[model samples]
Each structure stands twice: as C-alpha cells, then as structure tokens.
Target: MIGLVLAAGAGRRLRPYTDTLPKALVPIDAETTVLDLTLANYAEVGITEVAIVVGYAAETVASRVKGFEERYGVHLELVHNDKAETWNNAYSLWCARDLLTNGVMLANGDTVHPASVQHTLLDARGDGRQIVLALDTVKKLADEEMKVIWSESAGIERITKLMDPASATGEYIGVTLIEPTAAADLTDALRVTWERDPHLYYEDGYQVLVDKGFRIDVAPIGTVDWVEIDNHDDLDRAREIVCPS
Candidate 1:
C-alpha cells in the first residue's frame, strides 16, 4: 500500500521557527526532523510509495527529503498545494485523492511514531473496513487535540471534531488507514464543508461520513511512543519521547 503525508500546513502555531522553514523540516534530534522520522517509519513498514503534499517553503521541504528518496527505496511524489494558506488539511487530503485510491495509510507530516505502530494498524485492516482511525487514550488531552467518542458495538460510529477540552473523552492520534470507497466519501463531504467553511478541518469531513452510517473502526494505539509537534514545547517533548537529548 502507499503512504500519504499531509505536509501542506503553514504551522502558524510554530511561529518564528516555521516562519523560516516548514514544520516538517524543523530539526528534532540527531539530524532527523519531523518528516524524516515519519518517512523512516513508513519505509520500515514496507510502504515504499510515498506521496507528500507540500505548501509553505515547499522547496526546502523537498530538499530535505531528496536523499531519502534514493536511500530508503521510496518513490517520493511531491504534490504542491498553492492554496495552502487559505485551505485546511481536508484540502490537502483531497489534493492526493488519486494516490489515496486502492487503500493507503494517511498521516500528518509532523507526527512521530514507531514503525511497529504502523504495521499493527495495517495488520488490523484485513476485514475490508471503510476507515480505521488510530486513537490513543491520552491521560491529559489538551484543548487543541482532536477527540472522539467512539462506540465499541458499532466501531467508530461517531467522531466529534476538535472537541472542547471540557467535553473530550479520548485523543485521536493523527494516523488513519482508509479504503478507497471511504476516501471518496470523505473527499465528497470535504467539498461540501469547504464550500460553506473554507477552513474546515479533515475531521469535520470524517464526522459527516460517520453521520451517513459509515462505520469507521477505531484502532486504539494505547500508550505508545508518538508525538505531534505543533509548537516549541512539543518539539522538546518529541525529542524526549522519540530520540532524547
């Protein structure tokens, strides 16, 4: 299967650091950055076809990954999203819809996780489920993290996007495995949401799919080493969890 990395965001929360370079290219530990760690994990899972959607400072992000294209035997396809400044991640995923067909692993560029986690998720996809959203029970979910209220009886029957801090139940660890049919449904829903709210998040589209009686399997990652770097503090936390200074 192929891997799609959504790296088109401007990372406004990252401030001065992202002002000069894309968050994917920001150095973490040793010499690896967010994108480097993510690509390496994908390669380890035997996903050699990688598509990266780039936006702000695309050239620099592309340059950072050039070496890995040959080194890891991954065929890297870079798709540019010119409207990244105005659009959200839902748009970035839509941009790579063609590649996402035939089932693919989708991830955010700034998330760092173990290669084994990806393998585990893929192993769970044999039943032809429409969508599988990776989730983890976080001890303390911040207000900004995406949270979901899933039902074990019906799988991920419903997902609440950008859940309020006070109402959050569990955290959605930004990795998803989706079937082509589900991807198409999500893409269509995204179009509708975008027409009404240009800055709509990808989760908003997923919620629509849930409302349509589409079953999304919730795969709980459970107490794993994963990090989503959005700010300077997160960078430090990532270093500690992923590589450690």
Candidate 2:
C-alpha cells in the first residue's frame, strides 16, 4: 500500500516557529523533526513509496524530504498544494487522488505514531470496508480535535459531533486507511462540498459520507502511543512520547 502524508497546512496554531519553518520540519526530539519521525515510522513498516503533499514553505519541506530519502534509502514523492491557504485537508487529499486510487494509507503529517499504524493496517486488511479511521479513547478530549461516534457492531463511524470536548465519544487519531473506490467517492463529495461551501473543513466530508450511508469502520487504537502536534504544548507532549529524555 502507498502512503500519503498530508503536510500542506500552514499550521497557524504553531506560529512563529512555523513562521520560518513548516510545522512538519519543526524539531521534535534531539534531531528528528515531525516529518522525519513520521517518515521513519512508515519506513519501519515497509512503506517506502511515500507522497507528501506540501504547502506553506513547500521548498523547505521538499529539501528536507530529499535529505531524508538520501539518508534512509526511501522514495519520497512531493506534491504541492497551490490552494492550501484557502482549502482544507480535503484539497490536499484531492491533490493526490491519482496515487490513492487503489488503497492508500493516509496520515496527518503532524501525527507521531508508529506502533498503532501496524494495527491499523491489519484492521483495514481484515475488514473489507471502504474507509477505516483510527480512533483512540482519550481521557481528556480537547475542543480543537475532531470527535467521532460510531456503531460498535456495524463499525459505522459518524462524526455526529464536531469540536465538542464534552460530547465526544472518542478521539480521531489522524490516521486512515482508505479503499480507492471509497476515496474516489469521497473526492467527488469533497469537490461538491467545496463548490457549495468553500469554508467547510475536511471532517465535513466524513459527515457527508456518513450521511450517505457509507460504512466507515473505526479501528480503535486503544491506549496506543500517539500524538497530534498542533501547538507548542502538543509538541512537548509528543517529544515526551517519542524521545522521552
């Protein structure tokens, strides 16, 4: 399976560090940045063909990726998202539609989790579902993170609630395994939504799919070591999880 890393965001939440460097390139541990750590994680699972969708500070990201490829002997494909500023992550996914046709492992660039990924892939492979989104049961659900409510028996995941920390049933772990057929449908839905409502976030597309009666299975990565680095505090927490010095 091919890997798609959505690294196109400007990371306004992580500014002024991101003012000069992209969020993906921000140093996390002693030497590895978020992007490098993520790539290394993928490499560990034998996912060598990687496509990173880049935006704000795309050149710097590209340069860093090149260095990583040379050092790790991995193939990294860099795709640019020109409309990254105006569009949401759906646009970044759309940019790599061609590569994601069969079955692609989609990951958020800022997420650092290597262990859960293998379990996620196994879950996706065992079930013949169209989309499989990784989820975790966190003690404190933050308001900024996406929340999911799913049917345990049917494995039907629905974004029934948005950024409601109190109403959240579970936390989305920023990793998804998607079938090409469902991804194509999602792409079409995303395009329609963008044309109708340009300000909609990517989770809106998940809502659309759920509303359309599509079965999106939830692969629970229960209590796994995972981190989504959105702000400075999150980065610190991730460092503790990944480096632990």
Candidate 3:
C-alpha cells in the first residue's frame, strides 16, 4: 500500500499563512510543518512511496517536493486537484483516484499526529481488516469535528460532520487504510458525493460505501495527542501538542 495526503483546501480561516502557502506548509514548530510531520510519520512506518493531492498554493508544495523526499527519505508524487479552491475535499480525494489503486494509508495534511497512529492503522490492516480507520475515541468532540457512531458489529457504521456531537462515539481522525479491494468502491463513492454536491466532505464517501454494504473497522489511538489545524486557535493547540517548547 502507498501513503496519501490530501493537502489541497485553501484554509481561509487560517489566512495570512494560507494566503502564501497551504495550511500543510504552515509551520507548527520553527521549521517543521504539518506536512513535514505527516511525511515523517509515513516514512517512519516504512511507507516510502507517497502521493500528495495539491491545489491551493500547489506550487509551494511542488517546490518543496525534492526537499521533502530528501529529508524524509520517501518518494513523493503530487496529484493535482484543479477544483481544490472551488470544491471541498470530496473532489480533492477523487482527484487522486487514479494514483491510489494499490491501497493507501490516507491522511489529511492538516492533522498533526505521531507515527504511533500510523502504526495503529497499519497493524489493523495487518490483522486482515480491509477498510481501517484511525479514531480518537478519547477526545471530546466539538460540532465541527468529524464525528462517528459505533457500528453494531465493529468499526464505524456512520461518520459525518452533521452528526450531533453528543451521540458520537468518537472523532474519525482523518487517517484511513483503504485496502486495494475497497479502493474501487471508495473511488466510486467519492464520485457520487462530489457529483451530488461539490461541498460534501470525503467522509461522505465512506457513508456511501456503507450504504453499499462495506465494513470499515476502527483502530482507536487511545489518549495519544494529535491535532487538526483549522483556525488560529487550532494552530496554537497544534503547536502545544507537537512542538511543546
């Protein structure tokens, strides 16, 4: 399986920085960025071939491609999402549909997490769980968080941003292992989501797969610190969780 990162969206909430660079390029530490941490984690887990979907300020990430590979010791291939600024990540993910065939350890470029979370999903895949998700069951959910409810059997039966935070079992941490067999379905579902509405998130793709009878299991990274950088407040939290200086 290959590693994938969706680093497209123009994070308007995080302005100034995103004005010149994508959110993934915004530094959490002095020099290290969210994308840096993500590539490091992927490399740490022995995932060398990585695909990054880029759009807004895509040039910035393109310029750093060789540097990122040299530093992380991983081969990076960039996938362009032309609609990144006009549409949500459902399309950004669909843009990588051609590159993500051999299964993928997909992560949102805006999230900061250690290698352990990557290990958790990889381990689950190793155990034969085809569709795997890295969940943060320990963290308290907010309305904006992508929330998930427990399945009757196992994993997540439903995941969405519109779910009531009170009923959510946990947050879908934006890390997923889509095995090769499931990749086709995921691609199809992503297309449906984007065609139906350009504003839908990629998580809606998972929901479509569920409606078509796919089982997605979860691997909870219990209490381990991770942050999804959104606004200025989330950036501060990311610095605290990752840099900790």
Candidate 4:
C-alpha cells in the first residue's frame, strides 16, 4: 500500500505561518515540518511512494517536492485540488480517487503525530478490516473533535464532529488504513458527501460508508502525544509535543 496525505486545507486560523505555506509546511522544528514528519513516518513503515493532495498555497508545496523526496528517500506524487479554497476536504480527498485504487494509509497533513501511530495501523490491518481508523480513546473528547461511537461487534456506528462528546467512544486521530477492496466505495461515498454539501469534511464521508454497512474498525493508538494543528494554540501544542523546549 502507498501513503496518501490530504494537505489541501487552507488552515486560515494559522495565519502568518499559512499565509505563504500550507499547514503541512508549518515548521515543527528548525529543519522539519509537519509534512516532513508524515513522509518520514511513511518511509519508516516501508511505504516509498506517497501521494499528496495540494490546494491552497499549492505552489509552496510544489517547490519543495524534490527536496522532500530527496530528504525522505520517497517518491512524491502531487494531486491538485482545484476546489480546496472554496470546498472542504471531502472534495479534496475525492480529487485523488484515481490514486486510491490501491490500498492507502491516509494522513491529514495538519496532524503532527509519532511514527508509532502509523505502526499501530499497519499492525491492525492484519485483522482483515476494510477500513481501519486510528482512534484516540485516551484523549478527552470535546465538540471540536471528530468523535466516534463504536462497539466490538458493530464496529463504528457513527463518526462526526456534531456528536455528543459525552457519548463518544473516542476521537479519530486523522489516520486511516483503506484496503484496496474498499477504495471504490470510499471514493463514491466522498463524492456523494461533497456533492451534497461542499463544506462537509471527509470524516462525513466515513459516516456515509458506515451507513452503507461498510466493515470499518477502529484501532486505538494507545497513549500518544499528537496534535491536529488547526489554530495557533494547536500549533503551539504540536511544537511542544514534537519539538519540545
């Protein structure tokens, strides 16, 4: 399976940092970035070919493609998301549907996480689950989180940000393992989700899949220090967890 990254979001809340660069390019340390770490993590797990969906500030990421490839020793394929600035991630993800023909481990470009999270998903894929989502059962859920409600027998019953935090089982940590068998269905689901509402998140597509009787399973990442950089505060938290003082 190849690695996939959805880096099309504008991340307007990140302001100055994202003014010129995409959120994936935000510095995690002097020499590394959120995208850098994600590529490195994928490389570590033997995924050499990675496809990145780029949209807002796409030129910035484009210029760094060769540098990133040489640094990570991985081949990079850039997928253009024309609607990134106006539409949400559902369309951004669907734009890369052709590349998703093979199995893919998708990561959100805005998320800063450890390699262990990737390892967890890879290990869990052996169980034959069509879609394996990395869940953080340890994190305290809030309305902002992409919450999930699941059971061992039923798998994921629901996944959405609008769900009641008190009733959620955990937060999806922006990593998912999609088996090749489920790719076509997932792509169609995402297309439907975005067509229904251009502002819907890709997670909403996952909800559509669940509603259609997809066998989706969640793999808890155990206890890991990770952050989805949505705003300045999240950026600070990511730097603390990834770079420290």
Candidate 5:
C-alpha cells in the first residue's frame, strides 16, 4: 500500500493563500505546510512511496515535489488532474485510478489532522474488509459535513452531506484506506460518478460501492483533533489544534 493525496481543487474560498498556491501548499505553521504534514504522517506510518494528484496551481506543487520527497524521505509520484478547476474531486480521484493499484491511504489535501487519523485507518484494516474510513463519531456534524450512516447490521451504509445532521452516525474525516481488494470497484465507481456528474465528490464513489453491497467499515477516532481547511475559520481551527500550545 502507498500514500495517495487528492490535492487538485482550487479552494477559491481561501482567497490569497490559494491565489498562487494550491490549498495543499498552504502553511499550517511557520514552516510546515498541509502537504508537509501529510507526507510526514505517511512517513510516520512507514509508507515510503506517496502519490499526489495535483491540478489548479499545479506548478507550485510540482516545483516543490522533489524537496517534499527528500524532506519526508519518501518517493513521490505526481498525478495530473486536468479538470481540477472545473470538476469536483470525483474526477480528480478518477485521474489517479491508473496509478494507485496497490491499495492506498487516501487523503484529501485540504484537511488537517494529527497522524493518529492515518494510524486509525491503517490499524483498523481487517482481513476481509477492503475499505475503512477514518470517522469522527464524536464531532458535532453540521449540514456541510460529509456525514455517515451505519446500523447494527450495515456497518456504513452511506456517506454524504445530504443526510440530516441529527441522524448521522459521524463525520467522514476525509481519510480512507483502500485495500487492493476494493481498488477495481472503487475505480469503476469513481469513473461512473465523474461521468454522471462532474460536481460530485469522491465520497460519492464510496457510496456507490456501499450501495453495491460493499461493506465499508468505519474506524471511529474518538474526540480526535482535526480540521478540514475550507474557509478562513477552518484555517484558524487547524492552527489551533495542529500547533502545539
């Protein structure tokens, strides 16, 4: 298995920070960037080979790819997502389908969280289960959050933002483990999602698999500190929790 990061979208809401650089390159601290921390986490988990899907301000990430690889002691693969500016992550992820066949520790570039989130997903892997998502059952869900649905019989039946916040089991923390067993199905699902609607998230691919009788399990990272940096407030929250007091 290897590390895979989807850092393609133009986070327009972030303004100046994303004006020149992609959101992944946005600094979380004086020195570390969102991509930096992601690579560090992958390295910590012993994943030495990492693939990053880049678009939007692709040059910025491309220029620094070598440096990031050296800094994290990991081999890097840069996948290009041409439709990043106009399409949602479903297409961005589909663009990586050819390269990520050996299973993947998939992460969204815009999210910031401790390495434990990755650890949880990796550790939660089971012999028969092919997909395991890092879920935050403790976090209070808002309408914008990608919520999960699970029951005693169905582990994770669905994952989407359209679900009512009051009934959601947890928030899908934008981190997932795709074992080799599920790669082909996930690729097909992603392709179908992009073909159907370019504005759909890769999470829609997960739901596709779930609806097809694929048992997507959840690893509840209880009370974990994490943030998805979508807007200015999220950036502040990331700094507060990701940086030491």
Candidate 6:
C-alpha cells in the first residue's frame, strides 16, 4: 500500500503563506511543513511510496518533491488537479483514482497531527473492511467539522459537515485507510459526487458509498493534539501542538 495526500485546495483564508505555497506547505515549525510531517508519518509506517494530489500553487509542491523524498527517505509522486481552484476535493481525490488501486493511507494536507493517527488507522485495517477512517471520538464536534455517524451493526452511516453536532458520533480527522478493494467503488462515487455537484466534498463520495451498501469502518484516535490549518487561528493551534512555547 502507498500513501496518498490531497493537497489541492487553495486555502484563501490563509493568505501570504498560501500565496506562494499550498496549505500543505504551511510551516508547522521553523523547518518542517504539514506535508513534511505527513510524509514522515508514512515513512514511519513503512510506506515508502507516496502520491500527492496538488492543485493550487502546484509549482511550489513540485519544486519541493525531491527535497521531501530525500528528507523522508521515500519516493514522492505528484498528481496534478487542474480544477483545484474551481472544484472541490471530491475531484481532487478522483484525480488520483489510478493510484488508489494499490491501497492507500490517505490524509488531508492541511491537517497537522502526529504519526500515531496513521498508526491507529493502519492497526485497524482488517475485518473485511474496505475503508477505515481515523475518527476523533474525543474531540468536541462542531457544525463546521466533518462529522460522522456509526452503529454497531452498520459501520459509518453518514459523514457530512451539515449534520447536527448532537447527532454525530465523532469528527473525521482527515485520515483514512482505503484498501485496494475499495478503489473502484470510491472512485466511482467520487465521480458521481463531483459530476452531480462541483462543490461537494469527498466525504459526499463516502456518503454515496454508504448509500450503496459499502461498509466504512472507523478507528478512534483518542485525545490527539491535531489541528486542521484553515485560518490563522488554526495555524496557531497547529504550531502549539507541534512546537509549544
């Protein structure tokens, strides 16, 4: 299995830094970036080959590929998303459909978390499950977070940001383990989701999978210090998590 990162979205909320680089390249510390940590996590888990889906400020990521590979001791393959600025991540993920057939530990580029999150997902990769998501059951759910619903009988029933916070089981922390068996269904769902609405998130594709009777399991990452860097406030939280003052 390989590692996959979706780093296409243009984080307009994070200007200046995102002006020259993608959100993934935003510095979590003095020298390391969000993407750097992600690659290190993959390397730690014995995944030497990684595919990154790049869009907005694609050149910036392209320029750093070699350096990142050397630093992490892993090979990096960048997949370009032509519609990153105009379309949502459902399409960004669909852009790497071919690579998904190899099985992948997928993470959102903007999220900053330790390697333990990936370890949690990798450890839970059996039981005939196709897609296993890293869920934050310990975090307080908000309307803006990508929330999920799960039952004992039926894995994850729903995943969306619009759902009522009170009804959600937990927040999906942008980490997922997708088995090779899930590639076709997930890619098809992604295509359907983006074609139906260009603005839909990839979580909508997961919803499509759920509607089609596909089982998506969840692995809880308990009380982790992680942050999805969106605005300046989130960047501060990420800095504090990785390098406290």
TM-score of 6: 0.99
Candidate 1, residues 125-198: lDDT per residue as tens digits?
A: 86768788888766577667788877777676455555665665477778888877776787787777667687
Which scores better on lDDT, 4 or 6? Answer: 6
Query: What's the best-to-worst order under TM-score?
Result: 6, 4, 5, 3, 1, 2
Please, what is the TM-score per model?
0.92, 0.91, 0.97, 0.98, 0.97, 0.99
Which candidate tops TM-score? 6
At residue 243, what lDDT does model 3 achieve?
59
Model 2 agreement with the true structure over 22-134: per-residue lDDT tens digits: 67888886688877777776777777888999988898887776689976567889988898777777777777878868577888888988755655665556556888888
What tens-digit string does per-residue lDDT give for candidate 3 at 88-180? 999999999986678899999999898999998888776657788888988888899999987757556789988889999899888998888
lDDT of 1: 0.79
The local lDDT score (0 to 100) that residue 20 gets in candidate 2 is 68
Can you give the lDDT of residue 168 in candidate 6?
95
- Tens-place lDDT per residue, model 4, 124-197, is 97666899999999999888999999999999999999989999999999999998888899999999999999
Residue 135, model 2: lDDT of: 79
Stretches of candidate 4 exceeding 4 Å from the true structure:
none
Lowest lDDT block of 10, candidate 6: 20-29
**Candidate 5 overall lDDT versus native:** 0.89
Pairs that collide, model 2: none
> Which numbered prediction scores highest in lDDT against the true structure?
6
lDDT of 5 by residue, 1-245 (tens): 99999999889989899999899988888898889989999999999999999999999998998898889999999999888999999998889887657899999998888899888888888868788889889987899999999876778887999999999999998998988888789999999898999999999988898898988898898888889999989998889877768
- Judged by lDDT relative to the true structure, which candidate is superior, 5 or 6? 6
Instruction: Put down candidate 6 lDDT per residue, 37-77, tens digits, no spaces.
Output: 99999999999999999999999999998899889999999
Clash count (model 3, backbone only): 0
Q: Sort by lDDT, best first.
A: 6, 4, 3, 5, 1, 2
Question: Which whole-number lDDT from 0 to 100 does residue 227 have in model 6?
Answer: 90
Candidate 2 Cα lDDT to native: 0.77
